[model samples]
Each structure stands twice: as structure tokens, then as C-alpha cells.
Target chain A: MLKIDNLHATAGDKEILKGISLTVNAGEVHAIMGPNGSGKSTLAQIIAGHPGYVVTAGSVTYEGKDLLAMPAEERAQAGVFLAFQYPVEIPGVTNAYFFRSAYNEVRKANGKEELDPIEFLDLMEKKLKLVEMDEAMLHRSVNAGFSGGEKKRNEILQMAVLEPKLAILDETDSGLDIDALRVVAGGVNALRRPDNATIVVTHYQRLLNYIVPDFVHVLAHGRIVKSGGKELALELEARGYDWVMEAA
Target chain B: MATATNATGEAYEQAFGALRAQGGPSWLPALRREAMDRFSALGFPTTRNEDWHFTSVTPIAERVFKVAPTRSGPATLSPADVAALVISDPDWHRLVFVNGRFEASLSAFAGLPADVRVTTLADALKESPEFVAEHLGKLASGEGQTFTAFNTAFAQDGVVIHVPGGEIVEAPVHIVHIADAQAAGAGIHPRLLVVAEALSRLTIIESFASTGSFGAPYLTNAVAEIEVGNGARVDHYKIQRESTDAFHVGTTQVRQGRDSMYHSFSYAAGAAISRTNVYTQLAGENGETRLNGLYLIDGTQHADHQTFVEHLAPGCASRELYKGILDGSSHGVFNGKVYVDPVAQKTDGKQTNHALLLSEHARVDTKPQLEIFADDVKCTHGATVGRLDEDALFYMKSRGLGAENARALLTYAFAAEVLETIEVDALREGLEALAFARFTQSFGEQR
Candidate 1:
């Protein structure tokens, strides 16, 4: 479903993603694990078309189309989603309003009829149960004064509402407690379909236990150095990343 | 330049003389004479004045505007035309003024209580002379204000509202001031006097608008004085949406008695140059006052708001919030000051001003001043000027909103922070629709 060939990118004057290549097929869950400052989040943001990063030399093909040539919003309309590490606080925009606008935009782009507020609210109630979030949160400002776990859960709620084909979970498990992690992982697992895919980026192996991945890749110094089965995550968690770095 | 200024001053003097020649009322001639003298002495404020540093009234000073005729004449506006220019609601007690003259045919106050009195200032002078004499030109004096003096000297007609003690007014009083094409190249001064007696409650909406795309240059100098008696509550809303080629200067003075409450909201969205000043005095213990304002302008427009609150008694509180949205080289200014006297202890005051610039050339100036002579008081003030948050914009765009849609949404949200506080439903909805349409249209033009 996605292909990245020798992705060389930089933010400002410093190179972040050196030389990296990865491929993922349909219905497969991939986990990219690394230590701090290993470009795990950068790789996820680049795939979502964050404008801060400069892709000097690389090619990212999504469903046989060059993805790097599209703007961030266009990429979003084309079924790309990024669950932010730190969700933004829009002071006066309600979560329900934001979700409705986003859902209608994606629908319009895909040549589908837009849903009215009543229709959208009916669909939103079902998604709210998946994340175990209170309906009151939808009326409040988006992410303003929300708890860390609530923000992470809100991200998942958006992902469920949009139903993007390619979802990149960038450090989604950073600030969540154990209970929140279970609920979030459960929500993601429920949305897994035969034609869609997910790339979970994380620094620890705890999140993988709930939403088990089919393939595990260790990213060190902006390069994928090790690839193995689900057992590889347990091996790296037990031994640490230094061995993999030395081998690379 | 001196000759031009003299010419403008002489023109006003001639108009004042013309008004006096046809005036009634035994006690009005002296008041008008004194005010005219004060206006001549004060003249138009220059940029050198500290209060007028950020704003220049050169455009208003250079022009010589005649007094608009009292009658509508050939530019006769119908009831439907008047309804379309204001927040039309059948339940509201309304008074319509055209070119500073009361249009009784267009006004309605059918079922008001016997004790409550709502009429024109000109009629009140004849009906209840002593009551009109007690409050008129008292709180909003022409001592140090040039525009207030100008209004006092030239105001031919306006609205006068009086609520007796302990009477709760059910419907709001809506005062509509319209300037038609006949008012082109002329000046009109409209006055408002509201008196809420002890334990009474009232709401007043004063709106200024132009008639049907009237684009000629005119001047609207308006003044309002509100008296909140002991334990009384009053909510005053002033909305200014003049023609884009016109100029507006308005002043609102408020006095609160023991345990009284006063709330003032100013909304400015039109006019080439506009200035609004709100001043309040807490005269008795445990009084509360709130001053809130919002201004949205674009296309070389200039808008300014100046507010002052004085704490004279112990246990008084005041709060202020002003927000502005400027685009297309527009300029906005906010100057707010709070004073706590030596006798006023345990006073609580807070002030905040924020401005959002939508274009690269848009500008804003905010100044917050606090003068405290009391030992036990809590006061704080803050000001912020910034563009839209880039991260928030990106976050919205990532959720599938296009760049233009994201910017417009964020800009409207910034304005919604203040619009949400309006207690009146019809007025709030009207302003919200206007703001939404404005931002969307401007952003669409940019694209």
C-alpha cells in the first residue's frame, strides 16, 4: 500500500532522516520502534506531509501516486492521517464542530455526499463509545484544558470518524496510562480492515502488546537497521537498542 | 492649515446660532451656549495630545460638515426600509431617529407600564421638564470632552428612558439611529439618557446604521448618560455600523449607586474612522461594573476604544475585555485605565486587550494603565497583539480543511470569544452572522 525509497529529509539545516526505505502491504500492521532522537516521529510526520521538513532526495508512493508532490491538506483529503504527538489546543472550536467539518471535507473530496449535522451526530455517538469518551467533551473547546489521556483518546476518536486508509500513530502511547492504552489500542484494533493499514511509531514496546503488530522494525540514526517478526520487539525490549546500534 | 481649522470652527458656530434662533425651553439656551464655548475652546484634538497619540482626527477636522436637516424631505424612508436597517423585533420597545430627528411614525411603545416612560428627549422636555432637567448634560458633562460638548450643543432629538424604583422592565429598549442619503456632507448628534431607579432592572440597545448603501461622507457625534440607582441593574449595548465613508465619535458615561451593577458592550464594525469612549464611576459601596468591546474593521479603516473606571467607594469591582480583528491595512487602538481612590479599599479590577491581524500590513496599539492609591486592592492588566497560530492552522488543515477555510475559521473563533458573552439573542445572532459573512467574503477575495 505504501513505499518509501531512500527517504533523505532535513528540518532546517540539519539532516534528520538520512537514508531509509520501507514497504508495507495491505491489512498488515507495522511497528517502528527506536530510542530517543531516532527520527521515528519525523518519519511519521514526513509521510503525513508536514511542511517543516525538507525532502531533499526521496520518493514516497502511496497507492501508486507520488505523495510528496501534494500539499498537507490535499494528502489528508486523499486518505492520509497523522495522530499528533502533542495535540493542538484550538481555544474556541468545539470538538464536534471540528470533527463534522473534517468528515464532510474528506467525504466531498472522495465524491461522496456530505452528511448533515444530525446525520453526523448519529455517527459520532457510535464512535464515542469506541473510545469510552463522554459526550460533554465534544461540546468543549478542542483539546483545551484536556488531560493527556483525553487528548490521545480524542485523536483516536478523530481517526475512527475519518476512517483514513493509511493511519500513522506518531508516539500515540507517550502520555497515556495503562487503562487509556488498552482502550486506545482496542479502538485501533477494531478499525483494522483487509484494505487499510497502520504504522505505529513508538519508543517502547508496551503499546505493541495490546495492538500486536505483524512486522517489527528498529530505527536507529534515521535508518531501519533490523526487521523481524513480533518476537523482535520483545527481544529488543529485553536487551535494549545499543546492540542493534552497534551492529548497524 | 490655520485658516482651514478656523473655517471649520466658524461653520459649527454658525450652525449653533441657527439652532438657538429656533429653540424652545427656558433653561436650554444657556446650557447650549456654554457647551458651544467649550467646544470652540477645546477645538479638535491633535495627535500631540496624549489621549489622541495613536489616532489622528485630521480627516474629521479638515472637513466642514453642515447640520443635517430635521425633515427627511425628498429622501423619505418607509417603515420597511427602517426595519431592514436595525435588529427588528416586534417585542422590543423601539424609538427610531432619522438624521437626529425623532420619527414618531416609525416608532412603537404600545403596551409599556404606566410608571415607565420612554420618549424622545424633545418630548420629554415638555412632558416631564424637571426629570429631563435633572439628568440631561449632568453625568456626560461637556467639561473636558470636545465631542461631548459638540453633541450637547447641536443635538436636536434623541431617546429618553426612565424606569421608576423597583420596576423591572420586561422588554428591552431598542433605539435605532439612521443616516439616509439626505444626511450626506452633514453632521448629526444623537443623545441617549437612561435612568434606572433603585432596585429596578433595564436593558438598552443603541444602534447606529446607514440607510440602504448610503456611501456619502457624514459625521455622527453621539453621547449617552446612564444612571444606575442603588441596587439597580442595567445592560447597555452600543452597536456602530455607519457608512464606510462616514466618521463616528461617541462617548458613554455611567454612574453607579450603592450595590448597583452596570454592564456595557460596544461593537464597532463600520465607518472610515471611529472612536468610542466609556467612562464609569463607582459612587457607593459594593458596586460592580463590566466594560466589554469588540471591533472588526478592514480596508484602511481605523477604530479606537478608550475606557476608564473609577473606584470611589470600598468593595467595588470592575472588569474589562476588548478584542479587535483588523485586515487589509486597517488600524486598531485600545486604551484602558482603572483608578482606585484612597477611600476605596478592597477593590478588584482586571483588564485585558487582544488583537488579531489578518494581513501583513494590519496594525494595532494597546495600552493598559492602572492608578491605585488604596493599600488593599487587587488589580491586573494585560495586552496581546499577534497573528493566527500557525500550528493551530496546520492542525486544522491536517484534518481536511483547506488553507483558506482554516484561516477563516480560526479568525472567526477569535471573535467568537467575545460574541459569546452577549446576553441578547437577536443582537448577538445578527453580529455573529455579520462577522461570519465578513471573514468568509474577505478570505474568498484573497483566494
Candidate 2:
């Protein structure tokens, strides 16, 4: 579903991702484990087309299209979703209203009919249960004054509603409590299918326990240093990234 | 204190003399001449003047031309257009003025309640002789105010609304001041008098807008006097959304009695140059007043707001909140002043003005002043002018919205806080619709 060859990206003259290459097909989950500032989040943001990062070299193809050439918003319309590590707060814009607009924006770009408020609200009702979110959160301004857990869950709720093909969970479990982590993991697990792929980007192995990945890749010094089965995460948790760095 | 007369100043003097020569009433023209002497004596306001610190009336001082006598053409009005200015209030009185002239045909004054007096200032000279004479030029004579004198000199014709003792205006009294664009050089001078007698309650909504796509240089000079008697309640709103090319200068002069409550809202969204000066005096003990204002300016338009609330008696309270949104190099200025006399003990007053600049070139200057001679008073003031929150913008853009759409949404929300301050439903909706249309047009698809 996605291909990256020799990905080298920098933000404001500082190199963050260097010649990193990866490929993921449908029905597969990839977990990228890295130490702090080891290009894990940078790779995720580049794949999702963050404007701040300049991909100085390399090529990226998502769903058979040249992803690097498309704008960030177009990539979003083309089914690329990035669950932020730090969700933004938009005052006076309700979550439901923003979600509905975003949903229709993507739908409209694909030559589909947009759902009205009633239809969208009905769709949200079904998805709200998937994320264990109530009706109260959707009515308030977008992410304004939301609890850390609530903001993360709200991001998950948006993912469930948008149904992106390749979802990038960029440290989605950082600020969530155990209950929220379970609910979020359950929500991600429920959305998995053979037709879509999920990329879990994190520094900890606890999330991998809940949403088990098919392949675990260790990223360090702006490159994916190692790739192995789920056992790789347990080994890294037991021995630490220094061991993996030496082994790679 | 300062003396300099340019071409505009000489024109003002000639115009002032011309108005006195065409005298219609006995006392009004005398008051006009007195206002002219006051204007000449004060000269045009300069930066040295404390109230004119943020706003420079130099542009207005340079323009000496006058608006045409009266519109000789047909004013456009559609069914949809009527919806923009009409209110369905049948219990109280209604008055409509087009180009500063009374429009009896467009007004609705049905089921007139007894003891309440309502009439045009022209007719009020004879109908309510005592009321007009007693309160013609009572307020609006500060140390240095040139525009106030200009407006008082041209107080040609307007409406006078008075609620008798212990009476209540069951329905809100609506007033619409329509400025015609096709007649550019033609000027409009109007005065509004609202009096709520002791123990009475009244609500007045005064609006200023344009009729059609008018290019004529229009000058709207207006002064509204509001008198709140002991234990009375007065609610007032000043809405200005006229032609983008028109110039508007208005003053709301008010006096509060003992234990009275006066509330006011000002929405200035129209004209190339729009300035509103509000002066409130708490003359009686334990009286309270509130001033809420909102302004949205873009595309070279300028909106200036100045306010003064004076506490002459003890135990009075006042609070003010004025906000502005400037885009496309537009300029907005806000100046608020609160004065407490030596004897006004236990007085409480607070003022805040917050502004947002959508474009880098857009400008906003704010100044808040509090002068208290009394030792036992509480007074505070704050002013802020800034751009949209960058973090908030990033948050919206992350939701898949473009920069333009994100900006439009945030700017609309910023102005909505002040829009929510409007108490009238129809008025608030109209103002919001206008603000929304302008916001989207500049930053959204229309751009």
C-alpha cells in the first residue's frame, strides 16, 4: 500500500530522517521503535506529508501515486492520516463540525456525495461507541481544554470516522492512561482489515502488546537500523535500544 | 489650546455660518452657532489630545466638502432588503429615516400607547416644546471635541422618543438610518433623543446602513442623547453597516439618574471612515452602565471607537468591552476613558479592548485611560491588539483545512464573541450575517 526508497528529510536545515527506506503491503501492521529523536516521528510525518519537513532526497509512492508531489491536504484526501502526538486546540470549532467538514472534504475530492449534518451525526454515533467516546465531547470546541486522554481518544475517533487506508499513529499512546490506552488499542484493533495498513510509531513496547505488529523496525540515526518479527520489540524492551543499535 | 486652520477648517467655518443663516428653529440654530464657536475654539483634534491618541481625525479634518441637500432619486428597496432592516415589534414605537430624513411611509407606529411621546424633532419643536428645549445641547461639550461640535451644528432633523413616568415600552423601539450611496457629496445630520422617565424601561435599536451600490461621498453626522431617570432601565444599540465608501461620525451622549441601569451595544461595520464617540455620565448615586462594541474592518476601511464614562455621583459601576477585527491593511482604533470625581466614592469601572489583525499590514492601536480623583474607587483598563493564534491555526490546518479556511474560521470566531453581546435577535443576526459575508468574501472563496 505504501513504498519509500532512500527517504532523506530535514526540517529547517536540520537533518532528521536520513535515507530511510520501507515498504508495507495491505493486511500488514508495521511498528517502528526508536529512541527519542531517532527519526521515528519524522518518518511518520514525512509519509503523511507535513509541510514543515523538506524531503531533500528520495521518493515516496502511496497507493500507487507519487506522494511527495501532492500537497498535504491532497494527501489527506487521498487517504493518508497522521494522528498527532500533540493535538492542536481550535477554539470555537466543535469537534463534530470539524470532523464532518473534513469527512466531506475528502469525500468531495473523490467525486462522492457529501453527507449532511444528520447523516454525519448518525455515522458518528456508530463510531463513537468504537472509541468509547460520549456525545458530550463532540459538541465542544475542537480539542480546546480537552483532557490529554480525551484529545488522544478524539484523534482515534477521527481515524475511525475517516477510515484512512494507511493510518500513522505517531506516539498516540504517549499521554493516554491505561484505560484510555486499552480503549484506543481496541478501537485500532477493530479497524484493522486485510484491505488497509496501520503504522504504529512509538518509543515504548507497551502499545505493541495491545496492538501487536506483524513487523517491528528499529529506527536510529535517521535510518531504520533493524527489522524483525514481533519478538524484536520484546528483545528491545529487555535489552534496550543500545543493544539493538550494536546488533544492527 | 492649539490653533491652526487649513482649507478644511475654513470650509467648516463657512458651512457653519451657512447653516446658521438657514435657521429653521429658534434655539437649535443658536445651539448650532454655539457649537461652531466651540469647534473653532477647540480646532481639529490632534495627537496631543488624550482622546485622539490612537485615532487621528486629521483625515476628517482635511475634508471640507458637504453632502448634497437631499436625495432626488428613488431609493432601492427589495423584499429581501426589507428583511435586513425590519423588526416585528408592534407594542412600541418605530421610526425609519433615509438619508437623515424622516420616512413616515417606511415606519410602523401602530397601537400607540398613551403618555409616551414619540415625534420627529421638527414636529417635536411644537408637540413637546418643553422636552426639546430642556435637553437639546446638554451633553457632548468636552474640552477638545471638534466632530461633536460639527454634528451638533448640523442637527437638522431626527426622532425623539420619550417614555413617561413608570411606563414600559413593551416592544422594542427600532430605528433604521439608511444612507444612500448614489448621492455622494450629499450629507446627513441626525439627532436621536431617548428619555426613560423614573421607574420606566425602554430598549432602543438604532442602525445605519446603505441602500444600494453608491459611490457618492456621504457624510453622516449623528448624535443620540439617552436620559435614564431614577430606577429606570435603558437598553441601546448602535449598528453601522453602510456603503464602503461612506464616512460616518456619530456620538451617543447619555446621562444616568439615581439607581438607573443603562446598557448599550455598538457595531460599526460600514463606511470608509466610521467613528463613534460614546459619552456616559452617571449623575445619580448607585447608577450603573455597560458598553459593548464590535467592529470588523477590511479593504482600506477604517473604524474608530472612542468612549468616555464619567462618574459624578457615588456608588456607580461601569464596564466596557470593545473588540475589532482588521484585515487587508484596514485600520481600527479604540480609546476608552473612565473618570471618577473626588466625591464619587465606592465607584467601580472596568474597560477592555482586544483586537485581531488578520493581515500583516493591517493596523490596530488601542488606548485605555482611567482618571480618578476619589481615593475610594476601583477602576481598571486593558487593551490588546494581536494576530490570530498560530497554534490555533495549526490545529485547524491539521484537521485537513486549508490555511485560508482555517483563518476564516478563527477570525469569525474572534468577532463572534462581540457579536454575541448584541441583545436584539434580529439585529444580532443581521450583524452576524454581514460580518460572515465580509469575512468569507475576503479570506474564503470570494477572494
Candidate 3:
């Protein structure tokens, strides 16, 4: 339920996303792979409503609504989620407290009743198990001193709790170890539904093994150079992006 | 300038004479005379002085505050009124002072050990003259300090707590000072003396607040001296919440003996002009000192905090963290100095001061001074003044928090970093609620 047409974005004086077009329907998982500085993360952030980038000549539509017109917080309340590539550390705020506040804000926006501490804790316990995280992590500061693997798992935990309609995972597997990658993928896989969609943006093909994608698109120089079925991922993994770049 | 100084000094001299005529202990007159002389010589600090460069005491120096008179009958405040000003449990030992005089009717302390004395300075002087003479004015000598000299010369009644050797005071001692309507145009001086003997453990909370809706201007000058005996532990907290038109100046001096520990926290959120000075001395080896403070001010309010930690013995550690949130045209200042003596090798000291400016006109000045004589020591200091982190705000907004809510939450979290270190459960919770409420009100006003 998402569409991007001729999306051309710029960050300051440099044009990052040039003439990019993509579309995805419900119940589908799309994997966007690219090399360094290929605008993979930029596309994800623009859709999530990051204020740092300017969409110069494009329109992004989500379920027949202009996504670019909404603010970041409004986008989040409307069931659009972005798992940051590098999560921000918020000192002096407990993880559980932050999660509860965020969950209630989204619920209130959607005309749902807010959960109290006890009710939130009950839901949190189940989500914590989904990511295989210890209960103690809830008491510590939000990602203040968490390891790279723990931070990734925490992001997935949040995804499970929020249950967004459209989720974008940007470099979620960049800093994870083998076990952490498997756990994060398991959490994402468990939350999949026919009415929801996900976009996985990564530089490596290893994460595809865990959460297999229905469509594979190779991005180069801010444009999709190749699009194919699941076998394209293996082909690109075996041979580098050199062939794709030459053909494009 | 000279004539104005003389005029201010003459007014205080007359007040000192009046206080002397009231009569006190045999040795009090001479001490008061010396303090008065020192105050006259030092006068009020001007902007020319390095210590007072950022603050201007013109508002305080222009007005003359008469010494508050002693109440012959019961105070006008009710028990409920006093309870609202204090942040402590009902079961804790409490001493309530109104207009710098002890209010015995409102104060209570039962079941305390016989050796442990939690009484007023006046009573202590009459009951144990020798003990009072030994410790009083020993640590906080008003030599070059103008406000300390003024407080020592005028202070008539205050709290005196003494824990004998090896006594562990399970309950904290709460001292509540209230400036009512009568305190307007009056000078109220409150003194505190805490002596924790060897191996003793003590916790003390001092609160300065105001009552009545008069909104008249006044002055509250206070002094506190703490002596931590060998291997003793002391936790001290001071909360200042005066009227918006009042001026508050307080000094706290602490001395830690061999293997002793001292932790001091200062919270300043009121008054038109407020200054708090905390000086700690690590006199013996293996001692530790911690000084943490937080200030939240708006409007034309001005808050200043000066801290000095001296390492006189080896293997001592000192840490300081002070944070301020300024809004409107308010001004905030933080000056911290850490001294490492030649004999104090292996001294570990760190000082950090941060200020958050919520308005364009809000201002802050932070200075960290380090004097290192020992060859081998670790000392570091940092200061920062800025607005809230934009990245952090965006991150919070991305999680569905409104922009205003994100701003207010970040500001509260910045203050909570220092507030969470408080060991007293009731006091910590009370201050946290106060900070939260303050941020909510301020942010709502912005909307």
C-alpha cells in the first residue's frame, strides 16, 4: 500500500536520491540492497519523515494519502514505523518508561484506551520473550550503554509492541552477531500479517536468509538497476554489484 | 561607593548592638563583635571581585533589612502550613523554625537515644556550654566571607544536632525554616551545626521556604557547619524555595576525617536572587566527597552555586555535578574549584557543570578551576551551555510524543540525572514531582 514516483531528494547541497520509483502492496516484503553511498538509507528515512532531507521533485503516497505532508510524530501515530540505523541514546530515561509513553501516545492517537503500568508490564513481558531479551534491560537507561546486539534486539522488541502497519528496517543487521540477527528476524517474522508490509534495507545479503523477501531490488546511484524474484538475491551475493553497475 | 558601603555597614552595626543587648552565652558577644568587624571590612562584594563578577548584589545592597524580632507567643503558622513546606516523612525527627527562631510547639522528636542530641542552638548553649563552644564557628569561620560574617553576627536561634561516637541515627533529621508575612523587610539568619562522631551515620535535610501571600521582599542568610568524625558517614541535603521577591544566601562547610564520607546535594528553585556556597575538606586519607546540585529558575530569577573541594590527604576522591535550567531572562552561574595538596597523591577529582537555556535571553556562566600540586593525580572538568538536543527531540517525536511533550520530557530528564542520586526516598520523590510539575507548567505556558 505504498508508492513512490520519481523521488528526487537532497540533503543540503548534495542530491542523494535521484529519480527513484518503487511500489509495494500489502502482505509483501521488499529487500532493497545497495553498496556504500547508494541512497538505500536515505529513501527509508525520507519515507519516515526525517526533517533533515528535502524531497525536491517527488511524491510518496501511502494508502492514497500524501505521506510527505505528515509530521514525523503523526506518521508514527498513523502506523508508520522506522527502526533507525543508529538508535539514539536517551540518558536518564528508563527503557520501560519510554516504551510505555510511546505506546500510550500511539494508542491515544488511534482512539484506544491507555494502559496502566501493570497492564503495560504484562504486554511487555510477552514482547521481551519474543526478542529473547532479559527483563533487567527494562530498568536500565534507554540504549545508554547497551551492546550493539542488544540495541538491535531492543528495536525489534519495540516493533513487536507497536505492531505498526508498515515497518522499515534500515541496517538492522549491520551491527548484529549471528544469534542476534536470528532473534531479530524471528521477532519480525512472528509479527507478519497479510494486512501489513515491511521494507528491509541492508548492504549485505545474509539477513535475507533468515527473513526471506518476496521481491529483490538492487539500488545503484539512487535508482533501482535490477528487480527480480528471491533468486536475484543469491545471484547478487555470489557476484558483487559490479555487473549490476555495468548493466545499469 | 565608599559612602554607600559605610551606610550599609552602619545599619548592620546598629542591628548588631541591638542583638548584643538581648544577651546570650558569655562568649557569644565577643564572637559577634569579631564577625561584625570582618563584615564591615569586607563589605558587600561588587562585580569587580573575581568571585562576584557574574552576579550583581545591587538589589540586596540597596535595601536595609531589620533583624526579625522573637515571637513572645505561638507563631501564626499552623501545623498543616508547616507540613506543606517540608519534604519529609512524619516519623522522621523534625525541627521547625519560623523567622529564624525555633517553634517548639510545631517541632517534635521522640524516642531518640539519650546520647543523641537534636535540639536548638539556644538550648544546646545553655545545657552543654563546653560542647557548644568547641564546635561552633570552628569550621565556618567568617574571615573573608561577607555573607557568612553577616549570618554569624545576626543568627540567634537554629538547629544543633550531635550524634555521639558509634551512634547510627536510623531516622533522618529534617530542619524546616519558614519566612512568613512578618519576615518581610526583615533579615532572618538560621545556623546549623552537625557533629557526627567516630563511626556514626547521620542524614540531615534542611529546607528554606516562605509562606503568606504578602509577596514582600526579605532576606534569608543561613550558615551550616558539619564535622564528620573518623570513619563517620554524613548525607546532607538543602532545599531552597523562598518567595519570588526574597533573597537567599546560604553557606555549608563540611570536614571529613579519616576514612569518612560526605555527600551533599543542593536544590534551588525559588527566590529573586539566590546564592549557595558548599565547601568540603577531605582532611584524612581514604575519604570521599560528593557535591551535586540542581537549579530551575525562570522570570528574572538569578541562581548561583559555588563549590570548593580541598584534598588534604592521600587517596581521597571528590566528584561534583551541577545542572541548571534557565528560562525567561533568568541568569545562572556555577563556579567549582578542586584543590590537590602536595601530600594528597592519588587524588581523584571530577567536576561537570551543564546549563540548558530554554529562552533566547536566558544566560549561564560556568567556570571550573583546578589547582593541582601533587605530581600524581587525576582531575578533569567540563562545562556546557546549550539548548536541548535536536536529535534527541526528533527521536522522541518519531516514537509518537508530541513536540512540546518531547521538549518537556527531555528537560526533565536532564534535571533527573542529578535528582536520582538522592538517597532519601521521600525527599527524592518530592523533588522529582516538583521538577516534573515545573516543567509541565512552563511548557504549557509556552503553548
Highest TM-score scorer:
3
lDDT of 1 by residue, A1-248 (tens): 89999999999998989888999888999999999999999999899888789998979999999999988888889988999999999877789888999899889989999999999989999999999998898999899999999999999999999998899999999989999999999999999999999999999999999989999999988889999989999999999999999998
**Residue A201, candidate 1: how far off, in angstroms?**
2.0
- Each model's TM-score, in the order given? 0.96, 0.85, 0.98
Ranking by DockQ: 3, 1, 2
Relative to the true structure, how large is the alpha-carbon lDDT of every model?
Answer: 0.90, 0.82, 0.91
lDDT of 1: 0.90
The candidate with the higher lDDT, 2 or 3, is 3
Query: How are the candidates ranked when ordered by TM-score, highest leading?
Result: 3, 1, 2
DockQ values per model: 0.71, 0.30, 0.76
Model 1 off-target regions past 4 Å?
B1-4, B72-75, B212-216
- Candidate 2 local Cα displacement, residue B154, angstroms: 1.7
Residues B280-357, candidate 3, lDDT per residue (tens digit)?
Answer: 999999999999999999999999999999999999999999999999999999999899999999999999999999
The candidate that wins on DockQ is 3
DockQ-wise, the better of 2 and 3 is 3
lDDT of 2 by residue, B260-325 (tens): 999999988788888898899999999999999999888899888988999999999998989998
**Candidate chain B TM-scores, in order:** 0.97, 0.90, 0.98
